[model samples]
Target: MQITLMRHGKPVLAASRWLAPCEMGHWIAAYDEAGVHVDAIPPASLAAASTAVIVFASSLPRAQSSARALGHAAPRVDALFREAALPFPLWRCPRLPPFAWAALLRLAWLCGYARGADALATVRQRARAASAQLIAAAAAGPVLLVGHGIMQRLIARELRAAGWTAVSRHRSGHWGMARYRLD
Candidate 1:
């Protein structure tokens, strides 16, 4: 059985503006609601998606839109595949661009700064469940998952632990793909 985890296409949301730490919450909300730029999807992603017998996507607009753009008109949607919640600090100074803030916040989150968001352990558990779901789906044939970068990485770890062999190097960028197969 084979399973492929693909990051969604570039989101339509603009992340170039500088923002205070406290203002990141609003940005995160907007990003969650934003869709992908269909024209920005890579041809390789489209080709990989076409080889899958089943497609899955996160409930987020970006992932769903990516699935559609890749030719899956109705991918199975599930919150289990959603990106891990990003936690923002309440500090009012040191304004940074959205991407910079996301990087710092993600590092803080990894260091145990959940700030009311789902804890890393909880997110790992979810990844394990998501991995199981994908593996089950792959029993029918190749499975394609249009998901977020971080979540895809977490799920890839779980797939590896479950005895799946990585068929390709995993990429963490938008429109990147990681392929695995159960031997």
Candidate 2:
């Protein structure tokens, strides 16, 4: 089985809202007042994954936008492959202190949220679950799964843990495409 994980394109922030008590210490909100559109990478990474059988994207517009650029005739949207939900919004995390960060991370862990497991162990478990489902579906075909940054990393990490050598990663939260082949 082979799979590829890709991050979403740029996104616009929604209306401003007050932070929750748990988020008080760990949130720092920013604005792109004129909601900005994420620029498409001149050349997309999906083209390199030409051998893929089907393209999949997260249920988010940003991801769908990037998947459309794959040059594929059709890209399927998959909700199970959505990005990990951070304890706080992704847009509100520039000023959080270490303790608060730890607290939120702990919160994520305490909950049954496997996507943001808050530890490498949890990441591996979540990745394996996703990979197992993929393997069960098509044990001998190439598939593309577009998701968020953390999930992508966890997927790559799980692939490595499952004995895939030669794993590589691009910059965080940036456009990325990874290929994995299972022997």
- Considering only N, C-alpha and C atoms within 3 Å, which residue pairs clash in candidate 1? none
For 12-48, candidate 2 gives per-residue lDDT tens digits of 6554345543453333223211222546653546464
Candidate 1 stretches greater than 4 Å from native? none
Residues 1-77 of candidate 1 have per-residue lDDT tens digits of 99999999888976457899999999999999999888867778888998999999999999999999999999999
lDDT of each: 0.93, 0.58
TM-score of each: 0.97, 0.61
lDDT of 1 at 135: 96
Model 1: lDDT equals 0.93
Tell me how far the alpha carbon of residue 64 in candidate 1 is from the true structure, in angstroms, after superposition.
0.1
**What does the lDDT come to for candidate 2?**
0.58
- Candidates in order: C-alpha RMSD to true structure: 1.0, 6.4
